[model samples]
Target: MPIPSTLIGIPASPGRAGGRVVRVAEPPGEPATGPAPADPAGEAARIEPAVELVSTRLTARAATVSGDAREVLEATVTMVGDPALLQNAQELVTERGRPAARAVWEAANGFAATLSSMGGYMAERARDISDVRDRIVAELLGLPAPGVADLDAPAVLVATDLAPADTAGLKPGVALALVTEQGGPTSHTAILARSLGIPAVVGCAGASTLTDGSAVIVDGATGEVGEVATLDEAVEAAAAAAVVTDWDGVGRTADGHVVPLLANVGDGPGAAKGAADGAEGVGLFRTELAFLSAAEEPSESRQREAYVAVLSAFAGKPVTARTLDAGADKPLPFLSLDGEPNPALGVRGLRIARDGSGGDGAGVLDRQLAGLAAAAKETGAELKVMAPMVATAEEARWFVERCRTHGIGRAGVMIEVPAAVLTADEIMREVDFVSVGTNDLAQYLFAADRQSGPLAALNDPWQPALLRLIGMLGEASERTGCPVGVCGEAAADPALASVLVGLGVASLSTGPGARAAVGAAIGGLTLAQCRERAAVARAAADPIDARRAVAALDG
Candidate 1:
């Protein structure tokens, strides 16, 4: 008997969905044996043509990709064209007398182990190279391209995994839902689906076991994927329901009051869209996007173009652009970063900015500050530059001074570390404003990984301890007469928006689609009511009680 199944995973996209499964399998395996090479040197000579062919093909397709994808491919090209790898392979062939291809394979594996050990951005680059090498080897042995489902029609897509590049061309309207056997909530597929508001489920075991044309129903909100027939009745029952209202502006309460709605954007194009969608301004424009997608440090002109686009998109509205916050987790290949036992706590954010260690080299902060200042001067845009992971007043002052020296008048510090919040007044004295990066702040506060499944219980933003910390920051901001805002996922949550407003957040920034809903929720209450609700929430014993308190306030 075939039991109806309802697999659950992370929701990457959002929408109602009912469709058939389209399974895409992994690439086929390579042959076990091949024609023997004549000699060591001869073997090396024999493989030269194949290496050149792979190199040429990669170079030819280089222009097709842009932004982060382009950077990944470029690094791939570099690894394939690495003279050291080829040299090592040739040496191995001449000394050990191995087949040329086999020698290259062994050499590549050794290089890969070194890369894995190095970690950081180099490790990510190495993985890309390894992937390409595998594909090239397969091609050389006459194997077909990796299995790819023809997404010719709209269906609930199921696969073992998906690459970021594979998701770039996904047809938003047609692709109603997706399920993958493996992927974290923060992976590229999940991020893209969420951005597109498409329903998705990731990390579902046996997700690929579902055959093609097998009917399924995906519930993005709950991360549920079930057989279609099992859900068809429910789908039919809800088919006649009223159209969903647009919830895209400033959140409001029962009674209307104006609340700032903002967007956390990564690039110029995204900023433009967010602004068009009625984002009051950019809450967090991650400058790292400019750096990540480049072979070298982006030229001042290129940086200017990105900055200007974002600033112009918001027009006279304020745009808070955080400087390069790269670290071990999101490293740049060109930057020489040593592997850290605990990277999150190691040299990252302001630590890296101040120390110039971990491959930033001397004058790294100066160049970043100067570029941002120049971009501001050229665009004449209302831009505020902030430093991430600021922990102390001294660090805040150091960053502010650097920005001031570069002619950037407005400087802010991200309140991600506990020390920053604890010393908010001192830090405020050295900067223009403070924006709570609640996600990391909460993670650090609770000693939990926001991305870890086992730590989910500790990751709730509404936890009383986290709320108290936020309240402390709010009180400090009030005492110092400094504007305080929140630019994190918590800022957009409807359930938490009122408490945040009550906590005296001057602005609440989230994704573009969530702006209206948050704005509407905020509009329903006055500052005094929000404060009262926040007090009730703070005084509550647990998240459950706190949520009830928030709900009462909303009611």
Candidate 2:
């Protein structure tokens, strides 16, 4: 008998899932142009309010979601308010005598097409732009915006591509796999799927050809979609593979080198959830969520209340909290930062705190530190405050001094910049601990944008150059007597996590779902084995060879 057809796509998430395919309906086509208004200015006047309404809706959605999904929706909101898009559309309506709907359609599609044509990560953003277009056009047409809701049963979602909004509402475990016709690995669909730990395949041209209700197998790690096994078998295999879940407690290698397993969380609720799932402590507690959710700077009392919740959840356990990491990608109107040609290299993280805020009388950083102090006093949580984007010993000392003044016992700096790594010993003397943010460090180290799927190879955690930098930080920890931890996506990979511990990463913070698997991987190897693998990885030719070297350790 002939084998079933298979479609290959970019693997967005790792895992296998199988079920009957369920196709979501395509977005509605742009409606025919309505009669041109007698007064073009009056038609143009409708633009702002429509944009405002969509912004509010997007903001509402963002509030309900968290993590990458929230970021995607927020980006869409920004696009909806884009001056260029609005100006071009308004010009179409006023000058060309087109109806509001038609003008919006032309403008949004023009913008989206341009981005999609650019290829790579820019093309991936086309979905978000198109999502905004759909919302605005839907509002003008007096119809509900397109989305996927009301799935009757477990399904493998098959579509051309899922918008950020559509993927946000899906309940975990309900969607077996996400297969998209067009999207790269970093697309909203892929990011959301990874967070959910589900199977997903993106950029599959033939994905839309799959029949609704037809049984199909999806290997998300391999980006393969075909009929190889029944859905029941896949579930059974997953259950079998999850055997290591029973092994819990402090992470240790087979030869008993201690490795602390921690969680990366957004808030207290997330921290508590991680703890319940066997997290030893909170490795990364992002404080920006509170600020991102607020219209203005949250009061010290509000920040204190928020901090207390996170601290209380971890209670006596260590919690490494990052102070407000705003600027550039996350701009606060209250913060006075002039536009820069390269915002990535501009006032971001701790640098934002240095800009001298002109809004509130007390500095934003001061308030944040004060809140951390209050939370520490109230909960007696082992809170360790940290700053992002600290590149020098001077900045490290300043942040550490501030933490100490505020009565927080511990402070650290995220050593993601190249300068930080090169001068890590000097910075280590100023701070209590160091955390390596491999994600950004890799991006900046390689000059490869992580957002771009084409540059994904450069950002791979297994890259020898990245491992070498990590090794440098590890050695610095020994020389300076400051513990170093890895609080990045690299810590989530089982094999990579093992290599990380071998390289002298004292702690590993990963998503709660990954903590157990990482711990288990560590438990399976000895410290010497890990060190050997790390050594081999660093000596490897490249990322592919580095990963191969690490994989050989498993054998």
Candidate 3:
């Protein structure tokens, strides 16, 4: 037999493993034509039960996990139960005389298309809609729902890409690692894999062509996959990776330059995990947790309790909390825009309040800041608050004023918009600090959809243009004396972590599972070496050459 050529991909979660491949089967295709129901109402009624079953199943799955995984599953459950989806399905069944399964398929595709057209985070939601649509349609057809089949033994799970529910349900003991032909660093597959401490390589060129049960090696750090001589050898490699190592509660390069290693957390449990994993503090406390399940704005006290849970966990360590980042992909029932042609570019993040929509969305930010202030007082924690999607210096000043009104001493803005990077010096002068959200930044910079597999290269952190933007922010931070941090999927990559530090980022914030590896990667090198590599990476013409040039620097 011929040896399989090594496949290159993006390193999502850092670790190394090897195993026999267990390919996840594709979802059920378009359902066959079925006999029309006797009545349109009856056909439409069938949609509810199917949706309920899928929702119940998803809810159960969510119960077994917490933090980001739980949030992803719960969001999917909400998608399953969306009334708009029901109405769309009903209209198709009643007006078009379609069967329940076909109605659901058509309705879901239409909605997914709308989301895809919006790009950025919205495109990712489109994939989730398709996953839920498949499960619900399968229920109506009396067929088993699509997902990773239950693993009877330890193996590498290979797929085109995993859905949120599919990735959330994976167990580390049985699912050795994940390798997907499609998906980018900021994809749900990458985020969930890091949370689970599973090695993952996404966007592998030839991953889907490997046969089921073939022995292969998956190096998540290097994004390499190739055939191994035997399954025994693969098992040995995986077993070797199982040995545990602990992280000392300090983050610095070999030459003694301090780089704060913080954690991106969603809730109390996630905060605790991050702290336990030696996170200096919470770099990004995603405030969306309080909003995701709420039908309306949560009370100040309710929001305070949730904030207190995380702030108290970190204690004296600084916890940077971001206000509600809803709309676009994460539309809230109470705080959603009406019929925006492109919600991704519309009233999302800071604009949700600043856009002057009929609702007092600005009040939403005010109340949130008030709740965070209350929580900070109650917990006696070092609370640093920030707003997302601030593109201009004026917007940065507006957010800072809101933070000041709430008596929050520290305030910042997330550098997700390209304009934020371009005018970073001006914006930084208006705030205390800034953290770059490389995921959204990459999408907007390249004008490529973040969730599109084929466009993953453009969204990749290795892109010179993306690094140049971060460099611009770093330069601004230097001039303004405003600390810069990265709390994005890019920070989770061990190699990129080094480059980001070289680019003058003050802190690197990532998933708890990634801290040790990122710390170790930086621990071996002096800041000078990191800076040299960053310069080398920036000089490369493309993502591929950038990665290769950086790798060659070790020699």
Q: How does residue 314 of candidate 3 score in lDDT?
A: 86
lDDT of 1 at 190: 63
- Each prediction's Cα RMSD? 5.7, 5.1, 2.8
* TM-score-best of 2 and 3: 3
Kindly give the number of clashing pairs for every candidate: 25, 1, 0
Models 1 onward score TM values of 0.74, 0.80, 0.92
Local accuracy of candidate 1 as per-residue lDDT tens digits, 341-367: 767777777677666565653366677
RMSD of 2: 5.1
- State how far residue 120 of model 2 sits from its true place (Å): 16
Give lDDT tens digits, candidate 2, residues 1-555: 111438866656656667778887677677677688798998888877888898998888788876556667777888888999999989988999888878988999998887655433345567788888877887887776666656889888998878887787676689888888866554566657766677787777688778877777776644577854566754555444343344557788887788889888877667777878778888888998888757778999999999998888888889999988767556566676665656667678888766654344237888999998899889978889899989999999988888878888899999889999999899999999999888779879988666655566576677789899999999999998999999987787667888898898999998765676678778987899889989999899986567656656556
Off by over 4 Å in 1: 1-5, 27-144, 205-211, 230-254, 289-306, 327-343, 356-362, 422-429, 438-555
The model with the greatest TM-score is 3
lDDT of candidate 3 vs native? 0.86
Q: Could you give candidate 3's per-residue lDDT for residues 1-555 as a string of tens digits?
A: 111437988878877788899999777889765677779888889999889999999999999987788878988998999999999998889988899999999999999998888765667789899999999988998887787988889989999878989999888868888999989877899989987889998999888788898998788776778778899887676566553544466788989999999999889888888888789998999998799778888999999999998999988889999988887567788875776777777778888888867277988889899999999998888999999988999999999998998899999999998988888889988999999888889989988778778887788888999999898888888889999999988898778889999999999999877788788888878999999988988888987788778878866
Candidate lDDT scores, in order, read 0.69, 0.78, 0.86
Q: Which ten residues in a row have the lowest lDDT in candidate 3?
A: 240-249
